[model samples]
Target: MKDRATVVCVRDNRILLVARERSRWALPGGRICRDETPNEAALRELSEETTLAPIELTYLFQFTGFNTLHHVFFADVAHHARVQPSNEIAKCRWFVPVKIATLSASIPTREIVELFFRYIRTLESDNVHRISQQAERVSL
Candidate 1:
C-alpha cells in the first residue's frame, strides 16, 4: 500500500482543501517519497500544494485504506494568509467544519476531517482531566 501524509490546516475554525483539475477536493498531501518520514512528507506536501507552511503540526491519527495508509496531521495557519496553488493543484479554499459535508470532496477527505475533530475532542478531554488532577493535588 502507498503511504501518504495529509494536513488538516485549521484557520478560523475552517480547514484547507485543494482540488486538482477535474478532481474532487481533498486535503493538501501526496504520497510519501523514498527515505522520508511521514512528518517530513506532510510538511513537504503542505508547502508544495498550498505555498503556505504550518505554524505547528500535531499528529492526529492514522488509518489504512484499500491502497494507501494515511497519516493525518493538524496544522494552524493565520486567517490572512492566502493559499496559492502549485501547478499540480487547481484551486485551494478553506471551508468551515460544518460545511465540509456539503462540499464535493473525496471520501478520504471526509473521513480525515471526522478523525481530526475526534482527535481535537480527545485532546480537550485529556487536558481537562490533567487540570482536575492538578487541582486535587493542590487541595491536599
Candidate 2:
C-alpha cells in the first residue's frame, strides 16, 4: 500500500489546507520519509507544508487501496497563529467544508474533507449532549 499521512485541522469552523499549483486541495501531509515513522513524517510534513503545528497528534485511521496505505491523523491547529506555504504548496488557505468543492482540489482531498466534516458533526452532537446533561444536573 502507498503510505501517506493526512490531517483535519479545524478552527472557527474552517479547515487548514494546502493547495498545490497544479493540484487540488489537500491536507498538510505527505509520504513517509526513508528513515522516519509515519508519525514523524506526518509532523514533519505538516510543519513543512502549512506551518501549522498541532498541539497533539495521533493516528486516527488507515486507508488501504490496492497497493497503497494512507495513515490519517486528525490534528488540532489552534496553537498556530498563522499558516504559510512551504515546499510542494502553491497556497495555504482555510476552507469551510462546503466551499472545498468550489476550489480546485483532488479526489483524495475531497474525501478527506468529507471525513473531517463528518467527524465535526459527531463532535458537535457529543458536545450538545454533554451540555444538556450538565444543564439538567445543575437544575437538580
Candidate 3:
C-alpha cells in the first residue's frame, strides 16, 4: 500500500477540502516523499495544495484505506485564513461534518473525517470526566 500524508485542517468546526479538475473533493495532502517524515510531508502537501499555513499541526493517527495507508494529521488554522488553490488543486472549500455525506468525496476522506470527529468527542469526554473528578475531590 502507498503511504500518504493527509492533513485535516479545521476552523470553526468545518474541515478544509481540496479538489482537482473532475476529481472528488478530498483532504489536502499527497504521497509521502522518501526523503521526508509523514509530519514534514503533511505540512508540505497542505501548503502546496491550499497555500494556507496552519497555526498548529498535530499527528492524529494512521488510517488504512483499500490501497493507501494514510498518516493523518490534524491542523488548526485561523478562522479568517484565506485559501488559494495551488499546485494541481483546482478548488478549495470548507464543509461541515454533517454536510460531508452529501458531497462527492473519496472513501478515505469520508472515513478519515468521521473517525477524526469521533476521536475529538472521545477527547472531550475524557476532559470532562477528569474535570468532574477533580471537582468531586475538591468538594470532598
Candidate 4:
C-alpha cells in the first residue's frame, strides 16, 4: 500500500483546493518519499502545488483508501497568501465546505471536507455540553 499526506488549508471559512490540467480538484498533497516523514511530505506538497506555505500544520486524523493510507493535516493560512499554481497544479481555488459538494472534485476531497465539518460540529457540541454541565454543578 502507498502512503500519502494531504493538507487541508483553511482561510476565512474556506478550504484550499488545487487541480491539475485535466485532473479533478483535490487537496494539496502527494505521496511520501522514501526518506520523508508524512508531515514533511504534506508541507512540501502543499508548497509545491500551491506556493502557499502553511502557518502551521495540525494533525487531525488518518484514513485508509483502497490503495493508500492518507495522513491528513490542517493548516490555517492567511487569506492574503499568494497562490501561484505550479506545473503540477494548473489552478487553485477556495471553497466553503457547504459548496464543496457542487464541485467536480476527487472523492477524497469531498470526504475530507465533510469529515472536517462534522469534526468541528462535534467539538462545538462537546464544548457546549461541558459548559452546561459546569453550570448545572455550580447551581447544585
Candidate 5:
C-alpha cells in the first residue's frame, strides 16, 4: 500500500476540502516523498494544494484504506485564513461536517473526517471531566 500524508484543517466547525479537476472533494494532502517524513509531506502538500500554511500541525492517526496507508495530521489554521487552490487542486472550500455526507467525497476522506470529529468530541469530554474533578477537589 502506498503511504500518504493527509491533513485535516478545521476552523469554525468547518473542514477544508479540495478538489482536483473532475474529482471528488477531499482533504489537502498527497503521497509522502522519498526523502521527507510524514509531517513534512503533510505540510508540503497542504501548502502546495491550498496555499495556506497552518498555524500548527499535529500528528493525528494512521488510517488504512483499500490501497493506501494514510498518515493523518491535524492542522490548526486561522478562522479567516483564505485558501487559494494551487498545483493540482481545482477548487477549495470549507464545509460543515454535517454536510459532508451530501457531497461526493472519497471514502477515505469521509471516514477520516468522521474520525477526526469523534476524536475532538472525546477530547472535549475529557477536558470537561477533568475540570469537574478539579472543581470538586477545590470545594472539598
Candidate 6:
C-alpha cells in the first residue's frame, strides 16, 4: 500500500485544513519520504505547509484506503498557524468540524476526519469511567 500522512493541527476546536496546490481540501501533509518515520514526515510536512511546529503531536492511526496507506496524526499547538501552502498545498486554513462536511474533501479523507470525532467521543467516555473508578477506590 502507498504510504501517505495527514497532519491535523487543532486550534480553538478547529482543524487546520490545507488545500493542495492542485487538489481538494485536506490536511497539511503528504506521502511519506524515503527512510522517514511517520512522526518525522509529519513534522516536516506540517512545518513546510504551515510554518508552525507543534508542541505535541501523536499518531492517531493508519488508514488504508484509496490505494494508499495513510499515517494520520493529531497535533496540539500553542498558537493558531497562519498557513501558506508551500510547494505541495495551494492554500491552508483552520476549519471547524461543521465546515469540514461542506469542504471538497476526498471520500477517504472525510472518512478519516469523521473517525477523529468518534475517537474523541470514545476517549472522553473512557476517561469518565476511569475517573469514576479512581474515585471509588479512593473512597474505599
**lDDT of candidate 6 at residue 25, scale 0 to 100:** 85
Q: After superposition, which runs of candidate 2 have C-alpha atoms over 4 Å from their true positions? A: 65-67, 123-140
State how far residue 130 of model 3 sits from its true place (Å): 0.3
Predicted structure 3, TM vs. truth: 0.97
TM-score of 6: 0.91
For all candidates, what are the clash counts? 0, 8, 0, 0, 0, 2
lDDT of 6 by residue, 1-140 (tens): 77887777777888888876667888777778889998998988888887878888999988888798888999877773455667666787878988888988877767887888898899999999999999999999
Model 5, 65-92: lDDT tens digits are: 9999999999998777889999999999
- lDDT by residue (tens digit), candidate 4, 10-108: 888888899999888898999999999999999899889988887888998897777888899997776688888985899999888888888888888
Candidate 6 residue-wise lDDT at 39? 91
Alpha-carbon RMSD, candidate 5: 0.8
lDDT of 1 at 117: 86
Instruction: Give candidate 2's whole-model lDDT.
Output: 0.79
lDDT tens per residue, model 2, 1-140: 56887777777888787888877777788889778898888889989888777888977777664455778887766654788898888898888878988877767777767875676689899999999999999999
Q: After superposition, how far is residue 26 of candidate 6 from its true place, in Å?
A: 0.6
What is the Cα-based lDDT of residue 129 in candidate 3?
Answer: 100
* Residue 91 miss distance in model 2 (angstroms): 0.6
Give each model's whole-structure lDDT.
0.88, 0.79, 0.94, 0.88, 0.94, 0.82
Off by over 4 Å in 1: none
- Native-referenced Cα lDDT, model 3: 0.94
Top TM-score: which candidate number? 3
lDDT of 3 at 92: 96
Stretches off by above 4 angstroms in model 3 are none
Runs of candidate 5 with Cα error greater than 4 angstroms are none
Root-mean-square deviation of every model: 1.5, 2.6, 0.7, 1.6, 0.8, 1.5
Give residue 125's error in model 1 in angstroms. 1.1
Estimate TM-scores for all models. Answer: 0.91, 0.79, 0.97, 0.90, 0.97, 0.91
